[model samples]
Target: MTKINAFTYQPLTIPSHTESVSKQNQKPNAQKSSFSESLEEEYEKLPLKLSKHARERIDERDIHISQTEWNLIHSKMQEAKKMGINDSLVLTKDAALVVNMPNQTVITAMGLEEANTRIFSNINGTIVINH
Candidate 1:
């Protein structure tokens, strides 16, 4: 296993090969490949993720959000985060999304019509996106 320095964020590689019976007491260490490291970096760079409940709500409501619209929402959410918004109600042309800014997660989603009659609590900001 590769250990990372908490302060430096650098990978500490351990010896992959172990010695014979003379060093039997020592624990074996597995080396992490560069590919795996790159994969982890890419995963960390993802902008947002949908919680299970949010995915269920979107599917149940038959909400259709295009990739372009999703990109816009992510960008706007990042801007909102910079402004000290923790939770936000994002209103798009057809959907309403309650997003947790710091975690970059969508907590819930619904159609605009359904959102209009509902009340959102615990939200510090609201983002209105036309697309």
Candidate 2:
């Protein structure tokens, strides 16, 4: 998109040499490198330690859930398996505990429908599991 001035002088008349080593030796402009260019070209390159330290930090923050919560989560997981449902499964209701069990929350927050199924029961009051 360069705009050429009509008043500029004519093009150079020298026959261009394709194999000239002197022409090849000319340095490229440093500012126009691709987005994925290596950082070695500038002072802004990430230090080698940064990536290693980030991975170590992530490893340290890996968390484990309580056993009781884990059991509930596992049971819900099995139900999903039985239904042959994937992450895209749709639920008709909002999975919520507002009045009596507001303190309880869905163990695994996957899909919206799965969340509803995990929190809701047809029978009200305390859940009575026969198993």
In TM-score terms, candidate 1 sits at 0.64
User: In every candidate, how many clashes are there?
Assistant: 0, 0
lDDT of each: 0.83, 0.32
Alpha carbon deviation, residue 8, candidate 2 (Å): 76
Q: Residue 10, candidate 1: how far off, in angstroms?
A: 73
Q: Residues 36-92, candidate 1: write the lDDT tens digits.
A: 567456435546888879877987999888767888889999899999999999999
- What's the true lDDT of residue 91 in model 1? 95
Model 2, residue pairs in steric clash: none
What are the root-mean-square deviations of the candidates from the true structure over C-alphas?
15.4, 17.3
TM-score of 2: 0.21
Across 1-131, the per-residue lDDT of candidate 2 in tens digits comes to 33477555566566567458455644353333442255323212211111333233323433222344335533543454455433222121222111112212222223233344464433233221122
What is the clash tally of candidate 2? 0
TM-score against native, each model: 0.64, 0.21
Candidate 2 at 43: error in angstroms?
Answer: 45
